[model samples]
Target: MTNATRISATLPPDLAAFLDEYQETHHLSSRSAALAEAVRALRDQNLQEAYQELGEAQRSGQETYPDDNLDGLENE
Candidate 1:
């Protein structure tokens, strides 16, 4: 099943131009595809940062992970 939603967004001229350039440089089928790729990269980067924080917290001997219980993780 495809999970696609349509939405409208307004971008400033410079950003709009950049988006066009990005779209052209990447040879994407459409602006939506370029934006999707950018968003996916941003999401992956954010996840990596969050995971790094979690690992640091675990190694630092911090007592709690508010969003995680550290359950089922074998000792290093």
Candidate 2:
């Protein structure tokens, strides 16, 4: 059984063709898998940028988000 949910999307002509070619060239099982990989890559990039911003804020002594009891929660 698969854990994927299906949805319909309308892509531009050029992007749709590119996705099809990429799927074929990389031997992915389906276009859905290709799209999932692309989204995961984008998410990783955004998360890295966010971590960098947080680190800079800490270094510059700027008040960012609340530093609640997060370390305590990790042991629970």
Best by TM-score: 1
TM-score of each: 0.76, 0.74
Collision pairs in model 1: none
What is the lDDT of every predicted structure here?
0.80, 0.79
User: Which digits, one per residue and each the tens of the lDDT, describe model 1 over residues 1-76?
Assistant: 1678997989999998998999999899899998888877887787678788888998999855776544333431
Clashes of 2: 0
lDDT of 2 at 15: 96
Give the range of the ten consecutive residues with the poorest summed lDDT in model 2.
67-76
Q: Which TM-score value belongs to model 1?
A: 0.76
Candidate with best lDDT? 1
Model 1: lowest-lDDT 10 consecutive positions? 67-76
lDDT of 2: 0.79
